[model samples]
Target: MLKEERYSVILDLINKKGILKVSDITDVIDVTEVTVRRDLQDLDQRGLLKRIHGGAQSTHPIKLEKELSHIEKKNLNLDSKIHIAKKIATTICDGDSIFLGPGTTIELVHDYLNVNNVKIVTNSIHVFNGFIDDPRYELILIGGSYRNKTGAFVGSIANDILSRINIDKAFIGVNAINDNTITNSNEDEGMIQTTILNNALEKYIVADSSKLNKRDFYQFYTLDKVTAIITDNNISPENIDKYSKYTKLYF
Candidate 1:
């Protein structure tokens, strides 16, 4: 494809999908990672999209793109998720009540939780399945409509459940955050997440490096809503410093 055509395609990708990872663009455009990086640079220069560490996304109020299947997300950022997950694991106490969000990164929290006698509640079916059978943790699932693409429960039922439960710290997952806001790809899921955030004593958000400065459909809360955010090392120290003025940002 010509440079102009590729440019349009890149814009289209970001518009359709709230966030476009580097690999996702390369896969769609049949180009080298280096070539894709150049394309992203050009797009960012034109102010059509913002260049992230690993991808480009639209500059408009972020919206959910076509959601990915659970398997698709699980392996996308394995190492980064593991690092962020490990940090989150350390924050939990033996008897603390916690709520986990419906996100692949948040899924790692359940996978790594080996603590004895901890009560965990979630609207994530994958999270529930990961630990429901483990007798060491008291796993409670907030029943709601299942999103096949994400294997998460959201909507009214999930919102209702979150309202009734009290959690010490809720680990909310996010797709992107701008200066002051935390947003998600799915609108309905954002609604349920807001409920979880409102009820928790402390809320922690887990997202990898690529999500900073990006925005998506339906914001759940602002930076003040959470006590801290745990992200991968790839996030810029400059960005972390900017975010830290509002909330504790952990790498």
Candidate 2:
């Protein structure tokens, strides 16, 4: 492909995912890191995108809510989610009641859970399937209405169920985070998450670094509401300082 063609493709990728690694762009555009960096620089100069340490991000910080299918999200930030999930597993102890909110990152957390005799409350179908047959966990499925788009339960019934249950820790996920506030695309999903956080004794927000410094529609909670944030180490030191004052941060 020509330089112009590669530029268009790179821009398109960033627009869809909000962030893209230089290595990821190079592999797709059949170019070297030097070439990708030049493309990103040109785009950055044109005010189309912002260049980061190893990737490019949308110039605009806030993103409107977009409904993404579960399959689409399954692979978007798989590695980062896996790393965050592994660390999250170590923090849970036996016989604790936890709430796993609906999100791709929270679903992955199920894979790393090894603690015995833990009670899990969740509305995510993916999380339900992950441990439906496991004997070690006592799973509580917060059933109500199912939304095929997100493959999760959401509605007043789900909300009421969560209100009655006490949560030791709530692992919540958001579509985006900006200026210490968490937001999501769907109001119903966001409302359910709000209830989970309110009912929990401790709240932990689990998201990949890509979700940081970005915003989605329907603001839910501020960083001060959470106990700590669990994410990948790709987060910048500047951000750590900005958010650490409000809540504990774990990268």
Candidate 3:
């Protein structure tokens, strides 16, 4: 088939399905893996689609009004989360006070922490539970109206408590980062994250590659406010160049 015909087929599949693997295109178009990859790369360069590790996803922003439950989000990008968690863990030092926000990616940071004499403040039940039995750390759980879906505490009470304390560092997660804004699915949760980030000496946003260029329901903060964005290495070079123009990125 001609390249133009192959492009049309590939674009139709991506538009309908939102994402398509190289093999998926190959199966339908009778093209080799190399040819499919070339097509995807060309389409990505033209801004028609986004090139991911093994697939091409739509470039359109994903606007989510409701977030996935904790269990559902835990395994979505497990390997990328693990890599980002390990990188974030190295930034913590002994005797430092930190704030951890709610999210599956942030929750994984607990497994890689090797620091001692650290104090942790959080509104996440999952985050609190991770360090509850550890002898070297002090854990403080912010209490408020609990959200069952995210396993987090979010309300005026949680915001009030967070406002009174200042921490050395804060690691917050988000539903999406699009253009210059960082957003969340819930307004209350976004307010709490904003409060913690504003009060901390250093602020970091933890997100995977998939969260880049996406949109959520509520805008809480901007890219310029954070110290840096810690993401996985799977982020495309084009995105790295684009986002890095606004803030630092640690992959």
* Two-way lDDT contest, 1 vs 3, winner: 3
Best by lDDT: 3
lDDT of 2: 0.85
Each prediction's TM-score versus the true structure: 0.73, 0.74, 0.75
* Candidate 2: tens digits of C-alpha lDDT, residues 24-112: 89888887899999989999999999999999998753456576888889888788888888878988999999988777877877788
lDDT order of candidates, best first? 3, 2, 1
State candidate 3's TM-score. 0.75
| Tens-digit lDDT string for candidate 3 (1-251) | 99999999888777645567899899999989999999999999999999999999987635464688999998989999999999889999999999999988888888999999999999999998888888889999999999999999999999999999999999999988876679889999999999999999999999998998777888899998889999999999999997998899999
Q: What would the TM-score be for candidate 2 when compared with the true structure?
A: 0.74
Runs of candidate 1 exceeding 4 Å displacement: 1-66
The CA lDDT of each predicted structure is: 0.83, 0.85, 0.90
Clashing pairs in 3: none
Stretches of candidate 3 exceeding 4 Å from the true structure: 1-62
The most accurate candidate by TM-score is 3
